[model samples]
Target: MSLRTLTLSLLLTLLAFGPLSAAIGVPVTPATTESATATEAAALEAAREYTASLKSMTAKERRTLKREQRRAVKDALENHQDASTNTILLVILAVLLPPVAVLVYEGELNNKFWIALLLTLLFYLPGLIYALLVIFGNM
Candidate 1:
């Protein structure tokens, strides 16, 4: 084939496949806000149905159900307790060490350590939002 003809054919091929390549690479975004709202509504409906079912059950049956759920959770925790404990410790160390290091490095032991400890505890509840406000002031 002629050089010009070969170059033109390759350009057209690339142009045709470029969008296909992009489509293949693009990750699928989760459902939009409206779909998320619908999903939450469905979950609420399911919870209401489950609660209504529980109300119809006898006290003995309810107690048995609770016992079974507790047993299952206990068993699962026991099986994975080592890994779970390690993960929890690692996360605590990660979140705590940075602030403590900063406090010690700056030699603000009295004020900074107490504030960092308080912020770290609060972070366990409301998380980064509380930390951000405490450390950096409100955005």
Candidate 2:
């Protein structure tokens, strides 16, 4: 090919890749080592303050606080119990029903919902075990 034709081809190729290379700006260097140490120290100080606050509360005060919190929760739940329960049930049904319906219509019981339900029941066993552990520890 002529020099002009070769030069034009090279220019076109560079032009095509020019925007891509230009888009990749300078690489970002990480924060200085001193700044990282300061950040870690700050986080540790905040956690220590939080733990100190928790440790400052007396057992009786904590129990009374928890009891009041539970009473508030109970009152709120009582006020909206039926509506909340129905809404949760509806959401669960909506999520599980469509796939379940399809499975039943197809005469298949091996769907993900059945598997998930079984797994959830099985997972509750661990929670029961943990409760037993806590109960026996207190005895």
Provide C-alpha RMSD values for all models, in order: 19.7, 22.6
Q: Which residue window of length 10 is worst by lDDT in model 1?
A: 124-133
Candidate 2 residue spans exceeding 4 A from truth: 1-22, 60-139
Error of 1 at 81 (Å): 6.9
TM-score of candidate 2 relative to the true fold: 0.28
What is each predicted model's overall lDDT from 0 to 1?
0.58, 0.53
- Error (Å) of candidate 2 at residue 25 is 2.1
Off by over 4 Å in 1: 1-30, 81-139
Candidate that would win on TM-score:
1
* lDDT, candidate 1, 60-128, per-residue tens: 999999999999999988887464454344333334453543353345666655665676566433332
Q: Tens digits of per-residue lDDT for model 2 on 13-85?
A: 6545655546587576899999999999999999999678768999997788789989999999888746445
User: What lDDT score is found at residue 61 in candidate 1?
Assistant: 98
